[model samples]
Target: MDSLKVKAYGKINIGLDVMAKREDGYHEVRMVMQTVRIHDNIKVDKASSGDISITTNLGFIPTDKKNLVYKAAKLLMDEFAINCGVSIDLQKHIPVSAGMGGGSSDAAAILYAMNKLFKLGLSKKELMERGALIGADVPFCLMKGTALAEGIGENVTRIAPMPECCILIAKPGFSVSTKHVYEKLRLNEIQSHPDIDGIIDAIEEEDIYEMSSLMGNVLESVTVKEHPVIEDIKMAMIDNGALNSIMSGSGPSVFGIFDEPEEAEFAMNAIREMKLAKQIFLTEPHNVE
Candidate 1:
């Protein structure tokens, strides 16, 4: 049996702005999400009886149809009317529900590997479109790089020559529920957005300072206040000389952006010494080698 392995890269929200809640029960969002070098490894093989089997070391994660990877494979087989079974083994290094879009990345990788293994020959655009059904961020992860996402996270606009930056991701021992975070949000609450124009300009000019200053996540307000330790993690990064720091996604994982790998490494070591979070990782941007 032939098998193929693919890298499932995690993502960081460089800038996330929650515009407003829509009638569809989802919020309108404007975000610049970049895939980082941090990743989970996935290996897929052909299965005999038209069954999907997923194995992972992370006991907390589901391996059944509830998993996004399983759903993604099912979507492709059903859509293209193909007949085959697939066995997916995931080396789940990324923390679950850590705001890094780990699950979404894995799902996207599964779709990509299956497409290639089965010789489906789907274009990148078609794969992204199909990926949208798996999750809001799955499509973006399908074509990893830098992208501006909107409209429940399905609308994607690509950005080229994204500056090289190092990432420091720190996940605390606890997890925050996305549902609870959204429910706690208040429409009338005072809100601020990252400098969208400044961020775009930074990407265009490849300016690290400008990019750092513009990195902000509106969801931080909901997560930080609930867990004071989250604020501590941000402070630790800043104190360690991170160029910019922000909480990613809806919860507990926080990332510090650095212009130099040395700076990011310093911050990672500092965070590790303090033992503030469950784990700390130093990584760089994703360009798909």
Candidate 2:
């Protein structure tokens, strides 16, 4: 194929816990990541000039080397001694820097597509290894679906898909720096950590309620303290009939899982009325086949 199109799905962290600061200056974390239906569309085509170029619907995203997609293409070309270039057109629907893994997913999609376009015949493991060099979340984005992520988020173990449920995601009109969140984290002062194993079991059992109740993120303490609006969004979701709600990943974006679509829609409408979320999406868990 000379060109390919792929969907880069977003993710939500059902649970996140900071274990310890690694010697490499990265924090060890344990988290359950689940892909959602929300995604960005990426189209990659071979270019003859051997010059990487990227275009996105969003103006703020960099089209140059600063963009992760460009980095992914360059990594592939340089590593494999390929003489071709690629043109990446990103139609972004996922919120940027809202803890949804938008950029990482896009990067992963490019790697996957480029491998096919160039017929590189790279194994999934090889692609994942390459992705790790780009970003911690890139490997998981390539894997997609549900998984247990640890070791600065690069080490991933595929797990059972999350139970059937409607997910309502909300992102406030601000961004949180993952670096800032981790820097501000005091692992020693953590009051409680999420029941990571329990949530895993709940997913295997297909118990949506149990899984929802177990949802937690230790980073919430740091992010919510800085921006009280995160807490407000959680409360709004719960008040509107969410089984449980928690901030996904670092900050700002919060998600509520509901057993019924009607309940999720109700919660979405209520949250919309409150104007707590700059962007709200009603979606569901996406399991990669």
Candidate 3:
């Protein structure tokens, strides 16, 4: 095939807890991550001109070497000594730097597509390993589905997926800097961590309520302090019938699990009416086939 079109799925942190800060300045984390149905569209094609080009729908988004997708494609082209040029077009829907793993997922998707496009014969494990060179979240983004990410988010373990229910994603107009949140986090001041073990059990048992109730993110303590609106969004989600809600990643975005489709639709409409989020999406959990 000369070209390929793919979807890069977004993700939410079902639970996130920091264990310790490594000497490398990366934090050790244990989190439950779930993929959602929302995604961005990416198309990769060959260019006869023998030069790489990256383009995107958003005007401000860089299509240069600075972009993760560009880095991914460059990494493969350089490492594998591919002789042809490539053209990449990204149509983004996922919120940038919003803790939803949008850029990482796009990078992961690009790696997979390039592997096939060039007939590189890279295995899944090999793709994931190469993916880590771009970002810590790249490995998990390549893995997709439900998984446990530890050790700066690269060490991923596939786990039983949380039972499917209505998932509502709400992103405020602003973005949160992941680096800023990590820097502000004082491990000493943290009094609680998400019950990851319990969440795993709930997933295995298909207990949405139990899993939702157990959801938490220690990073919220930092992000919410700066954006009080983050907490406000969570409360709004809960008040409108979310079983439970929490901030995703180092986030200005908050997501909630609802009991049913009707409640979820109601909650989405209500949240939309409140003008609390710049973007609101009603979607369900996504798992690898």
Clashes of each: 0, 0, 0
lDDT for each candidate structure:
0.86, 0.93, 0.92
Give the better candidate number (1 or 3) by lDDT: 3
Write the residue-wise lDDT of candidate 1 on 1-289 in tens digits.
3699999999888888888999877888888888988889999998876888899988878999999999999998888776678889999887789888999999899989988988888998989998898899998999789888999898888886467877899999988887788778776784777876678779888887888888898888888988888889899998888888899889689998877777778888888888899978888888643
TM-score per candidate, chains pooled: 0.95, 0.99, 0.98
Off by over 4 Å in 3: none
Total colliding residue pairs, candidate 2: 0
Error of 2 at 168 (Å): 0.2
Point out the worst 10-residue segment of candidate 2 by lDDT. Answer: 79-88
Best by lDDT: 2
- For model 2, how does the per-residue alpha-carbon lDDT over 1-289 read when each residue is reduced to its tens digit? 7899999999999999888998878999999999999999999988898899888899999999999999999999998998887888999999999999999999999999989999999989899999999999999999999999999999999999887789999999999999999999998888999999999999999999899899899999899999999999999989989999999999789999888899889989998898998999999999987
Better of 2 and 3 by lDDT: 2
TM-score of 2: 0.99
| Model 1 root-mean-square deviation | 1.5
